[model samples]
Target: MVKRTAEQRVLLDQIKQIADGLGQTLAPFCEVVVHDLLEPEQSILAIHNNLSGRAVGDPTTELGQARITDPDYPQVLANYANQFADGRQAKSTSIGIKDASGNYIAALCMNVDLTLFRSLQMAMGQFVQTATDGPKETLDPAGTDALRDRIDAFAARLATTPRALKTEERRALLGELKASGLLDVRRAMETVAAHLGVSRAAVYSYVR
Candidate 1:
């Protein structure tokens, strides 16, 4: 066990405060820790959010040891892959803090559990999943008798007969037909007027 100087102790305390704030802000899913590099055997000075079930006075992790033992270890390791003891995936960021003498004195670390995110991803995938082998039919208006079928289907969806459809409903249906290029078909207006029990002139006004 190494002895911590007064300056290092103060620095660790301040870092602990930051870790606590970050832990609360990132709540429930993230664990924040402050490691006292001066004492590798009891490196963990504080832990917040507690996702990994680790505690204060825990020994330094392998990465912490690297920072302690190596003079050239990377100062910031961001978003690196990690895992919890129970096999939950984690994303971690470790930042090594150096004292005025250029010696690594502490480390501030954050571990984010990916379980919730991964579960949500899977749920969304299942939600959007569609059956692969059902009703390979097309609503393409250009198919034989398809335009009239589409109008009838639209009225059926509204729980009414085409000839009994309200004025707004007819106008909306004509808009749908116009949008599908079905109105471009020969005698399309005549077909629509006949189906809705209206004259071609009324169909033209609806199309407008």
Candidate 2:
């Protein structure tokens, strides 16, 4: 085991403080850890958020090995992808701390689980779906003029112009059109794209 100097101890304390702040700020999804390189067998000095099922006395990771064995190893590796033991996706960043003699002494690591955000995305998608054959009126005869009127009405409901509608709004409008069977008309996508000042592909993307 390596001996830690006073300066090394102070550096570890400061890094642990940062880990605590990050853990609180990104709570539930993020995990922050500080490792003591001098004691690789029991390197984890602190762990926050506790997402990975690890504890304060967990052993060092492969990253810690690089820091202990490689004098010229990089000090920081930011925004790289990682995973947990249970196979959940994560985005991680690791920072190596060294003392005045260029000896690696400690490390600060952060891992953020992305499953929550992905689940939220799926929920939003489901919420936005509208049922076909609902009571809403369909476009009469499915012509360009009728399509324009439908688009204008939907845009008005949102207090925005058709040309100013965002992607989500456009998608919602397409949903309405599909429910009304207006999207089944010949050249319907082309007509809508022309009215929205966007490409035909962009209009199709909303439905797809």
Whole-model lDDT values for every prediction:
0.90, 0.91
Name the 10 consecutive residues with the lowest summed lDDT in model 1: 137-146
Off by over 4 Å in 2: 126-208
Query: In candidate 2, what are the lDDT values of residues 1-208, reduced to their tens digit?
Result: 6676789879988988998998899898889999998999899999999999999888999999988999789999998989999999999999998889998899999999999989999999999999887897866445767789999999999999999999999999999999998887778988899889999999989998
Residue 187 of model 2: what lDDT? Answer: 84
CA lDDT of 119 in candidate 2?
Answer: 98
Deviation in Å, model 2, residue 109 alpha carbon = 0.4
1-208: candidate 1 lDDT, tens digit per residue: 5677788878888998899899999998999999988888998999999989899999999998998888589999999999999999999999999887788999999999999999999999999998898778766344437778999999999999999999999999999999998888877888898889999999999978
Tell me each candidate's TM-score.
0.61, 0.60
